[model samples]
Target: MKQRCVKPRFWVVLVGTLGLAVGCGKAPSPRFDSNLMVMDKYDISFEQQQDIANALAALFGTPDDPYVPKESGLDKDKIKLAAGPTKSDKAGVHTGLYREHCAHCHGISGNGMGPTAAFLKPYPRDYREGWFKFKSTERAEMPTNADLERILRHGIPGTSMPAFEVALVQPEIEALVEYVKYLSLRGMVEIELARQTSEELGEGERLPTTAEFLVEGVLKPQAEKWSSAETKLMPVAAPPADFGSPASIAAGKSLFYDVNKANCLKCHGTTALGDGVLNDYDQWNKDVAEFRTKADATLASLTEQRGKAEEDFATAVEALGADSALSEEERKQQRETLEKDKAATLKKLGEKERMLPTAMAYTLVPRYIEPRNLRMGVYRGGRRPLDVYYRIHSGINGTPMPAIANLVADSELPADLSEEEKAQRRQSLQTQRMWNIVDYVLSLPYEPGGELGADISMLGRERN
Candidate 1:
C-alpha cells in the first residue's frame, strides 16, 4: 500500500465542525465524519458512537488515506489514485479525484450533503444507503460495475450529475468507481455497527472490534453483494417480430392503462405528463421524512405561539393607555418596558425557528419523488429500447416503481405441459408482454394527444 500523506486542511474547511480526528501524532490525519444521522436514528449513545467511528477508521482509513480490505475486492491502487488531496505528483498522476469532483454535491462521506446539494431539484445520491436508482441488475441487487461506469460516462439526464466522459480518461473513471465502492462499503458497515451496538447489545456494551468478527459479521456480506451483481443481471431476450409495430404499441397502450397490468398511466398520467401521483417519497427521503415532519410540527407550533404573544402584547399596551391614575411620563415608561419585553420574546422565538431543520440544514433534504414526464422524452436512465426494457423489467430501485418481471407465475402455466416446457412458455409470454410496453413508451413522444382510440388508429395508419 502506498503511504503518501498530505495536510487535511481542505477537509477541515469543507466539513466544518463535523470533523472528528480518528488518529493522533505530531501531524494530524484526515478523518471521515461519522454518519451522525444514522447514529441518531438508532439512538446510539456517545460511547457507542465513538466505538463505531473507531472501528470504521480501523477497517477503512481516513479520506486522505483509505484502506480497502481484500474481502471488498476493490482495487487498492485505484483507490489510492482517487484518495487524498487534489494534486498531481511529479509524474502528473491525479489524486483526490473524488474530493475535487464529487464532494461538492455527494459530500466527503458520500452522504449527499455537499454545499450545493440543497439547490438542486432532485438531490445527488446518498451512496451510504447502498441503494441506487438506475442499474441493470435485479431490484434488490447491487448495480454491476458497468452500470456505475456508464453513469460516470453518460451522466443522468435532467440532473446535476454531469458526464465525466470528455474530461477524464477511462482509467480515471475506473479509479473513481473503486473509490465510490470504498465509501459505500464503509457507510454500510457503519450502519450495521450502529444497529448492532444500539439494539442487539445490552446498555453500555461495545461492538466487537476484532477483525474476524467485523469481517464475517459486518463487512463481507455487503462486499459479496457487489461482487455477485454480475450474476444477478436481469436477462433481456430479443424483441419479438412485431416489437415496434403499431399493433405492438396499441397492445402496450392497453397494458399501460390497465390497472391489473402495467398501469403506467396511474403514475405517468393519462397524457404521459407525470401528473398522476404527486405525494410519494423515494426511499432516501422516506427514511428522513419522520425527522422532517417533527421539525415541521415544531415550526408550526412556534408560529402559533408567536401569534398569541403578539395578541397578548397588544392587549397589555391598551390596558396601560387606559390606566386612570398614571401621568403621561409613567404611562410612556411602562409602555417602553412592555415593548422591550415583547421584543425579547420575539427574538427568542426567532432563534428557535432558525435552529429548526430546514431544506438547507439536512444532509439529504426530504423531497417528494416525481414520476417521469414521458411527454418531455427525457429518460434519466437512457432512452435505448434495452435501457427502457431493463427499467420496466426490474423497475427503478428505491422508488415507488415496481418490478413486473414476475408477470407469469408457475401456477399460471399450462398444467398438461412438462415442467421444462411450462417454464419455457412462461418466459416467452413475459418477454413479449414487456416488449409490447417498451414499444408504447418509445412511441409516446411523437404520438399526438387525442381520444385514445383515435390516437391509436392514427398512429397505426402512420406506421402502415
Candidate 2:
C-alpha cells in the first residue's frame, strides 16, 4: 500500500514565510479588493466595481483595520485580534493570527490564491464560496462554530492544513475562526452585489451601495444562515445493539454491492479501494471549469499568433539581408524598425495573456477529487463511528458523495398508510441503512487477509 504524504509543520511555516516575503517591501498596507473574477463573470463595469468596493469597505474595513457589523454576528474583538500585521504584545499575546499563520496559503482575502497556493495539490479553502466539506450540519447549511473550531484544533488528515491545537491557545483559535467568518460574510456579500448589478440592473444603472440596502437585502440573509447553522445540525441516532457484529458487517457488505442500495462499489471500487470513476471534480473545481476552459483556449490562440509573428519577423529580416540596393546605414535603420515592431507585437500579446487567469489567479486549475481509499483506513473527515455515520447521513458537502436517502420508497410501503406514516417509515429505514454502511466502512481495516489478499493476488496475476 502507498503511504499518504503529509507536509511537516516546520516546512509549511518555512515555505509560507518565503512565499510571503516575495510580496514584501510594498510601502502601503494591504487592503481587501473586490473579487475581479466574480465581477468579470457578471460583466460588471469599472464604475460599478468601484461602488461595490466602497460598499465592502464600509461594511468590512481594510485588512489593517477591520470593521465587523453588529448585524453580522461576528465578534469585533476577535476580528481585531486576528487582523493586521503579525505581532505580539510585550506579554506575548499574539495579534494578526490569520496573517501570520493562514494568509500564505488561504490569502489575506481568504480567496485561496496566496503565493504558495499553486504548489499545493488540493488548494486551500476559498472562504468566499461558503461551501465546506467536513461539517456536522446538512449539505445546504453553513458549518457550526464548533465544526470550524474542531478543524482548526485537529487539522485535516493528508492535507496542507495543520493542527493548531498545541501551537496556539484556545482563544487564538477562536479569534481565527471569527475572522474566517468575517471574510466569508464579506465575500458572500460581494458575490451577491455582483449578481444583482449584472443581472437585475439596467445596462447603465449602478448598484445601490447604501448600508440599508446592503444589510437588508444582501448581508442579512447570509448572516442569518451562519447564525442558524447549529440549529440545522443533522442529528445522529445511537447505533443498534448489534452495530459492529459480524451479522451487521455482512449486511453492510451486501448493501455495498447492491445496485439499488448504497452502491458504494460504483465509486469506491469492487475492493473498496478508490480506483473506480476518475473523472469527477468537486463543486469548487466544477464551478470554474468552464471559465478555465475558455481562458485556456484564448491562451492557446495567442500562443499560436505569437509563433506566427516570430516566423514572419524572421522572414522579413532575411528579405532585408538580401536587399543589396539599400545603403548599409539604411538597412541598419530598417532592421531596427522591424525589431521594434516585433517587440511591440510580442508585448501586446503578453499583456493579453497576463490578463487571463494564471496560476496566481482567483481560481486554480480544476482537479479531480479522489474518492477515499477505504483499504488505507484513512478518513479525511474523522474515524469515529459517529463521524462515519454523519458522513453517510448528510454526505460530505461539495463532493460527489450523496446523502443516504430513499431507502424505503413510497411504493414499497403499504398502500393504505397515511402520508406521515410513509414518511416515518422511510426515515427509519434510511437511518438503519446509514448505520449499516458505517459499520462496513469501519470494518474494512480489520477484514481478513484472505478477502483483501485474494483481490490483490488476482490483480497481480491479470497484470502479469
Candidate 3:
C-alpha cells in the first residue's frame, strides 16, 4: 500500500516568508512550487504547477481568502452565518451553511475525502469528476439545479448522508447547491490542466502553463454546460388515467424483463438485488479499455505498455526532491509492490479470451457502478412519486440506466405512419409505460420477499 502523507503547510508558510530560500541559505526553496510539494505524485514542472495552482485559487479561493459567488446565482453578501443553534429572522437565513453542514464529510475542497470519510461505507461522492448518479438529464450531462437541491433536501437512503430539509431553508439550500457546482467546476478545470500537462509531457511537447488559457479553454465550457443543465431537462409527461393500478403494475413487470424493451433484469438481476451480470463497467472504466478489441490480443499489448509506464512512474517518484519521512528502502519496496499488482491485473485480463457481448454489458466508462438493489427501497434519486417518474422518464445520467421514454419509439409502431403522428403516439406510449414501471418499482419493497408480479408466486409455501 502507498503511504499517506499529511502535507506540511507550516513549512510552506515559513519558507515562503523567508523569501524562497532554505537549507543553509544556499538551496532554492521548493515550498511554493506545487510540483515539488510532497503531496504531488505526478511531478509536473514548477511553472505549469504554479499556473494550475493559481487557476484553482482564482476560482475556488483558499481557506482564508474565500471566493463568494455574487453573479454565479447566490447572493454572497446576503448570506448570514449561523452561530450555534441561534435562530435568525426569515430574511437572515444562515450563510456558510455548506461549510457548517457538508465540509466535515465532503471536505472543504469538496473532494469527498473529508476527515470522517474513512469510516463510511460506499465513500462520500467525489464531485471532482463532475458526474452525478441521480439526475433528470441524459447520460454525460450535468444535472439540473433541481436535482442537486432535491438530493440535499431528501438525502440518500441507507447512507451516511443526511437530509437538510428541516435544518436549512430554501435560500440556504440554493446557496449550497451553487457552491457545490462551483467546487465541481473548479476541480474539473484542475483535472483538465493536469491531463493536458501529462499528454504534453508524454509527447515531449511544451506545456501550456497559462492560467488565462486554463480558464478560457477548460473552465468556461464546463461552466456553460452547468448553466445549461436545465435546458436538457426531460419533462415528465402526465401519467395515464389508470396510473398506479394493478394492470399497470403487471404490464410494467413484463416490460422490465423484455430483452429489447426495458430489459432492467439484465443488470438489476432476476431478484433486483444488483447481483446480475458481473461484467458491468462505468464511463471511466470503459475508457481504460477503449483500444481493446473483442478478442484478448490487446491484453499482451497493454501489458507491454504497462510495464514501461510502471518503470517511468517509479523513476519519477524516486527522482522527486520533496521532503518525505520514509527511508529510501521503504519507498522502493512500495514501488515494487505496485508493479507486482499491475502484473497480476494484466495476467487476469489475459485469462479472458473474448470480451462479453456489448448487448449484455452495462456500456459506460470509468468507475463501474453497481445496479441499485430495488428491493432495498433505497432510491438515491428522490423517492417522491414525481422524482421516480422523472428518473424513469429521463434515466440516471452517466450510468447504464436509460430513459424508458426514448425507448418507446422503437418498441412498437403507431397506427398512423406520418412522422408527426408517430411522435405523438410515441410520447403517449412512453408516458404510460414509464408510469407503470415506476408503480412496479415502488411496490417491490412492499411485496412478499421483495418479489414483484409473477415472481411473488415462486415463493415456497409452508408444507404442513
Top candidate on lDDT is 1
Q: Sort the predicted structures by lDDT, highest score first.
A: 1, 2, 3
Off by over 4 Å in 2: 1-26, 297-360, 409-419, 452-454, 457-464
Better of 1 and 2 by TM-score: 2
**Candidate 1 at residue 250, lDDT?**
91
Q: Each prediction's TM-score against the native?
A: 0.78, 0.79, 0.65
User: How many collisions per candidate?
Assistant: 0, 0, 12
Q: Model 3 over residues 1-464: C-alpha lDDT tens digits?
A: 65434343333332112233333424431222221111122434444555567655555454433454333333343233421223445796545565678877876556665777767754576676688877777657888888888889988876788989998888777777876786677666667767667665553355454645655666676677788888887677777888778899888877877877788888777776665665666553453345233222443566575566667666756654243876878777876766776665554443331222221131222345677777767777778777788777666765677766354745488565888888888878877887888888887766565354335333311100
Who is ahead in lDDT, 1 or 2? 1
lDDT of 3 at 226: 83
Instruction: Compare the candidates by TM-score and give the number of the best one.
Output: 2
Candidate 1 C-alpha lDDT tens digits along 259-311: 77787888877756676798999888887887667656757899788888889
Candidate 2: residue 28 Cα off by (Å): 2.7
> Which parts of model 1 have CA positions greater than 4 angstroms off?
1-30, 294-360, 405-420, 451-464
Candidate 2 versus truth, CA RMSD in Å, comes to 11.5
1-464 per-residue lDDT for model 2 (tens digits): 65434322212212102223322244346657457667656756556767787778778878888888899999999999999999989998789999999999999889887888989867888889788878899987899989899889988887888889999898999999999899999999889888888888885687786778888888899899899998998987788778988888888888877768887778877777766667898887887787677667767899798998899999998999999999999989999989998987787567546555432266777888877777667777778898888888888888898887555656777888898988887777777777888898998867776774245753432220
